[model samples]
Target: MKLLRLVLPGLTMIAVTYGLARFSFGLLLPDIKESLGMSEAVSGIISSLFYFAYCVMIVLSTVITTREGPRRMILLAGASAFLGLLVMAVTPNVWVLAVGVFLAGASTGLASPPYGAAISLWMSRAEQGKGNTWINSGTSFGIALSGAGAILLSPYWRVTYGIYAVLALLALLWNFRVIPRAEKRWKVTFEKGNLSLKGIKGANSLITASLILGISTAAFWTFSRSFIEIAGDYRSWELSGFWVVIGIFGVLGGFSGSLIEKYGLAFAYKLGSLSIASASILISIAPEKWLVSFASAGLFGGAYIFLTGVLLVWGIRVFIKNASLGIGIPFLLLAVGQVIGSSLAGLFIGAWGYAPAFILYGFIGIAAVFIGPKKNKAED
Candidate 1:
């Protein structure tokens, strides 16, 4: 019962911030580009802003959540999402749109670390991992909702974003009512936030793995739908259906906690990376094929969420003393990599095409597998 109370609202919050605010842009990008007269290069540069904002906010959120407690950061996250979505709904120019995207992305950065801190403070040790993974799966739910919205709203993307804004506002209120009050305040200090080299010992593998995965997955998140649309000439319904499939399968990632507990983090991590990498390669082979494309979306969505869940637990264990930093550091690196990857993928696609770009990214994901987690009994 207690778990449900936290996980439900937490999940909703994540869905709103990540799924609606951060990722829905990708699903809507084709329309947005058509409306705004954007080139692929311009779109990719704008998309990279999302990760750039995330990179900035994650560090700040980690430090603030560590010092002031989770409640404030959580509320701030919801507010950021609400405002960002509203801006997206009304943007008149690409610059305005970029501002909206940055705000929305910042919400995701703000949303994650506080939840890690919250779970640490409110939930028992046995339930913390479960709480983290379940809440993380909210991204999938949000994505599914956005896809459904895209199907129904079709070319009326402003209306879609407007509706999403209202939903974000509602989610913000829901979280405000549900998230626990800050119980205590810690003295703010540089060391307390765990940003030091000493704080990151034995975490080299986690850092490397997350950075690489971020780069590998950026193409899928930013351009996979565009690839399929161009290659297959898919109808509106089919394209949205592809997104819905990704979200539906991504719900499986909520079970990542169980997978990690049963099989161990190393095993689960490797499995997820392999599956995600394979998704990229598989789609590159025949993105025009309905089965192949949809399968790739499902594989990417499921494995992406599952791998992040594992990283969440892995980060928490590595920085056990500071839960916010545990979530922040890995996520920050992920965003950093994405910031680099989004622009590069855009250039690569323009230079070569989707297939080669995706294949190259797939090899990168496989490389991440070689930098596996160390044998840590405490984490196990």
Candidate 2:
């Protein structure tokens, strides 16, 4: 019962942050663009800004988690999500919308690190990996729920976002009740010129792996549905179904921890990198094929979530003493990579068209399989 209580709140909190706050933007953008007379160029810039906010918050979150601890930071993450959604629900202009997007994006950054701490602090050693991955899978739940709501609540972006705010508010309340409070704040000082990679082993490899994976995944997340819709001529609801399948299979990604427990991080990471790259290749080659489309969605969704789970465990393993930064730095690098890759993908699509651009990204994913040293071992 104690473990269940912690998992539910963590799951819902992640759903709100990753699913509602982050990915739903892509889903809602068509309506938002139509309503606001936005251009692709401008929207891309806004998207980059969203990632920029995510990157900044993730960097700051590590510091805050170090000084204040994870419980307090988690609450702040939920609050940021609520405020962001509320702003989006009522925003009358693009600038305001951008503000909302940034805050919402930051929530994902803020959400990640603390949970690492939470699990390390609360869950037993045997249970921790599963709990962390299970919580991570919450993003799938949020995405699926949003897709369903989008189908049912057609053409009401504001209402959709408003509901997201209310759900976030409830999630905030639930998390507040379940997540314990921080003890008195502590202060730590870092020298100006020198950096501290103290207590974190294999930081370089982790950053490298995360950055490569992030770049590879960016093209698909930002533009795959667009290609399927435009090139494949999918009916609107079919696209919704596409997203639904992704989320559903992503939930299945909770098994990543099981895979890691049985096989280990190197095996899991290699499998995920190959699977994710294959997903891109699968979709890019046959965007119009219904069978392939759904299969690609499933593969990408499961593999994407699985790979992030691998990272989470890997981070915790290496940065054993600093669990929050363990999670934060790798994820932050991934986000930073996304910021660069997503931006580059936008330009690449303009010049090269979707198939070639996607194929290039897929190749990069394949390369990611060999990023680090021969071993790719996680510290015990």
Native-to-model Cα distance after best TM-score fit, residue 203 in candidate 2, in Å: 1.1
- Score candidate 2 by TM-score against the native: 0.93
Q: Candidate 1 lDDT, tens digit per residue, 1-380? A: 27889999999999999889987887788899999999988987888778778888998999898887788999999999999999989999999998899999899999999998888887877898899999999999998888898888868889989998898889889988887676543332122444564646657877888899889888887779889999997888999999988888898999999988888988988898898899989999999999999999999989988888988999988888888888998888888777677779989999999999999999989988888776579666
Report clashes for each candidate as comma-separated counts: 0, 0
lDDT of 2 by residue, 120-156 (tens): 7766778878888889899898888887877776599
Quote each prediction's TM-score.
0.93, 0.93
lDDT of 2: 0.84
Whole-model alpha-carbon lDDT for candidate 1: 0.87
Question: Which regions of candidate 1 fall more than 4 Å away from where they truly are?
Answer: 36-42, 184-193
Q: Worst 10-residue stretch by lDDT in candidate 2?
A: 185-194
lDDT, residue 35, candidate 2? 93
